[model samples]
Target: MKNLANNVGVSTIGIATFFLTVVVVVLIEHFTTFNIFTLSFFIVFPAGALICGAAAASGYYFGALWLHRRPTILIFVQILLVAAIAQFAIYYGEYRLLDLGDGRMASDVVSFKDYLDVYLSSTHLRVGRGALDTGAVGNFGRVLAFTQFLGFIVGGIFVFVMLRVYPVCEQCARYLRILAKKTQLFSKQEDFTRFYDTVFEVPVDGPDFVTLMKWQQEKDEKAVRGTIQSETTLRGCPHCKTQRISQEIKVWGEKEFRDVPQLTRHLRIPDGIDLTSAFKTV
Candidate 1:
């Protein structure tokens, strides 16, 4: 029952943000002639559309943060619906505004399909630093249709990525509070290996865990050849105080550092164990 209430609250927030984003975007584009929704790269990737979609769906992000709850699949589907409607609203708003600007009294009289056809007919892709016009490719209407499809895809992808990337406390239905994070740099692979074993092999409540968690090192440019970097993070549920630890190790290459996925680990601390005291120390 509580989850149901949360879902309702989040949905309401999402709807509100969606409308606000649409109005702001439509008005900005109408006045500036920027066509933010149709902004693209290489005539395919909807870069501008992604920004607009994410803006429209931002309620989900803030809603989850404010409510301290993870969004459900139902809310995700609602965002997609918003994305579709947002695309239509953008184009329709543009059409109406253009007619009004032309001193037409009956801008509402034209059907949407007819307006879309006219809009596509007049549109052409420009390329190169010289802004060379590519003119119309064969069947320009189909091309524009595909671009609209990409807009929906951008919206869906943005929300989908946000849902997965943010960590949440499932049992408490709240986002985890990050307790501590530190990155340690090692001049030797063996040093990092020793650190890794100390973390994974020992119980987290032990004194060694406290000492290791406080470990720090300053980077030395002289030791570039065998250097490794390890990042450690601790998160706890605000309500339940359930704690989790995650670590990722990266090897310094000739040019950059790359993750060693096999060396990564995420562990849940046993119940009744609270490491807040250890983290409180410098």
Candidate 2:
């Protein structure tokens, strides 16, 4: 799963790069003097795909590393980085290619007005002319960049909330994880909750000596009638006043035989399982 997530994350970087490049090149084609690269650039799609894929792999590696620690922060950071870099490419494309001059502007580079033109401006529509212009393109471009910006922010929010979310691994060989500091099993207390008939194992400190010895004697007497009897242990949790129950479980044998082994689960709990003083018999 970690590998898959890293793959997706790195792919996102590549996707952002691809979009960034497109917005950059398109703006230049519409507004620049350099026609050489624009004419031949489409031919490089295969190359771009390969390069982007490799780059994405690298990005995935880095993101994978970063996410392991600060998942929430890294998620938003990638989105923010994509938005800012892609937008910068758009602005560069416009200035260098859209304006079609030497890519030089007499106005402030950072301000929106640097690319503004009266002819391109949409006010022409409200005033009646309505011929398509860079003003419209520029406006729409701003909208695209802003929308992506918000999406990036949202991805970050999702990661923050998911980290603490406990997924139930019910189908796993282990049944549940009690959230207590010391893990215990439900089976120990003979406390059969709603999910009975399901395979559940309690962590234990081995079977009690007296219990196992007593059961072994009973098994000898009833070998033909009801012979199968075994003893198990319960895990004692000192802090949480709980104990994980251990039960005799049947396992298939290789050649019509069997084995008995007490199993444990991946349960999480707040505290260790130990009975309260009243139940301790002390």
Candidate No. with top lDDT: 1
**For model 2, how does the per-residue alpha-carbon lDDT over 175-275 read when each residue is reduced to its tens digit?**
12232221112222232222223323322222342222222232234223212322233334323333443444333333331433443233232244342
- Candidate 1 matches the true fold with a TM-score of 0.81
The sequence of per-residue lDDT tens digits that candidate 1 reaches over residues 1-282 is: 987787778778878888888788789877786777777777777777777787778787778777775666777787788777777777776676775546672366677787777667777777778878888654775676567666765776588578757777757767887898777788866767788887767777888877776666663444375578888788999888888888888888787888989988888888889877776663
Q: Candidates' TM-scores?
A: 0.81, 0.27
CA-lDDT, candidates in order: 0.75, 0.36
**Which residue window of length 10 is worst by lDDT in model 1?**
217-226
